[model samples]
Target chain A: EPEVTQTPSHQVTQMGQEVILRCVPISNHLYFYWYRQILGQKVEFLVSFYNNEISEKSEIFDDQFSVERPDGSNFTLKIRSTKLEDSAMYFCASSRVQSENEKLFFGSGTQLSVL
Target chain B: LAKTTQPISMDSYEGQEVNITCSHNNIATNDYITWYQQFPSQGPRFIIQGYKTKVTNEVASLFIPADRKSSTLSLPRVSLSDTAVYYCLVGDPMNTGFQKLVFGTGTRLLVSP
Candidate 1:
């Protein structure tokens, strides 16, 4: 079973610093997404990417956040200025197609810790 | 996306069957009920999906009634390793261009030996 892989299983950064999280989606997948979960909170959607551009984003994804498909297989999420509240588990996911019944393959997740 | 309501937590013993139910009273015509399971410190994994009636897979079974207003996820003869949080999501995949899966507070199941 092919899966999505995320780098830097854990990251600790100071406030106001810039951080970039990288992910390699399944080779055949075309839709990629980023989601985050604060400790003891529900998972929240951040953004979705397709065709080398952002397809949609949630309110949680503000100016401080950006996503890119930097290469054929790599997808990245960059935070320009991290805040303490930015500490959470960031997950990368991908789906073979944009279908109602399609299931997403998720990475183990990158734990981002902002001090 | 239809809002889903489910139990916050459940406790079961090893080798027992566990059924987690989710209520989605406002489910739309095109909405599908999908279930995901998440262990602590990991991303959610797809368990099963169903439109109506019963859908069975290797891991679990999804039962949706004729009304389609609610669904049940049944895990047969669970073991300690089956402990995890179960999420129920309702959405119309075709209409959702971004395919964003809205997750509610999932049901945490603890299977003890």
Candidate 2:
């Protein structure tokens, strides 16, 4: 089965540095999303994207964060300045259609570690 | 999004059937109850989804009550490989053209031989 693939499975960066996480969602999927989970915590939604624009975002997605679909296949999340609290497993997901019944395919996840 | 509550952990032996129940008293009319499973260091994987009554796929079965306040995930003949964390989520899935899945602390199932 096709899957969402994320690059740099592990990322380590300085606290004040910028970081960009990349994802290649399923080729035919139209809706994309970003979620994060702190160690031993519940997974939290960050942002959702569709039609080349952000559909919704959580409070955690503040001024330091942004998402871009630079091309047909790549979805990227950028943090202008990283913080210790930003460290977590970031997941990328996609669905063919955004519906109550649609199933989402998730990437293994990018483990972001801030020093 | 409706908040869900489930047991923190469960233990079962191999070949036994396992049932994990989740409570969501605030489920909305458009919300669908879905379950996902996760192994250590991996993203959540879809298990089953249902709006009402029962829905079964090859991997698991989902049973939703008429009130839509609670749902159960049933795994038949579970094995050691079935040990993982299972999450129950309730949401419109497409409330604003995208599905924002909110995962609560999931139920951890440990299958022993």
Per-model TM-score, in order, reads 0.99, 0.96
| Poorest 10 consecutive residues by lDDT, candidate 1 chain A | A98-107
Q: Highest lDDT: give the candidate number.
A: 1
Q: Once superposed on the true structure, which residue ranges of model 2 sit more than 4 Å away at CA? A: none
Model 1 scores a TM of: 0.99
B1-113: candidate 1 lDDT, tens digit per residue:
89999999999999999999999999999999999999999999999999999999999999999999999999999999999999999999887766798899999999999
Q: How many backbone collisions does model 2 have?
A: 0
lDDT of each: 0.95, 0.93
Candidate 2 lDDT by residue in tens digits, A74-106: 999999999999999999999998665788899
Looking at candidate 2 chain A, the ten consecutive residues that score lowest on lDDT are A97-106
Tens digits of per-residue lDDT for model 2, B1-113: 78899999999999999999999999989888899999988999999999999999999999988898899999999999999999998888667347778788999999999
Task: Return the lDDT, model 2, position B66.
Answer: 89
The docking quality of candidate 2, as DockQ, is 0.78
lDDT, residue B103, candidate 1: 91
Which number leads on DockQ? 1
Per-candidate DockQ vs. reference: 0.87, 0.78
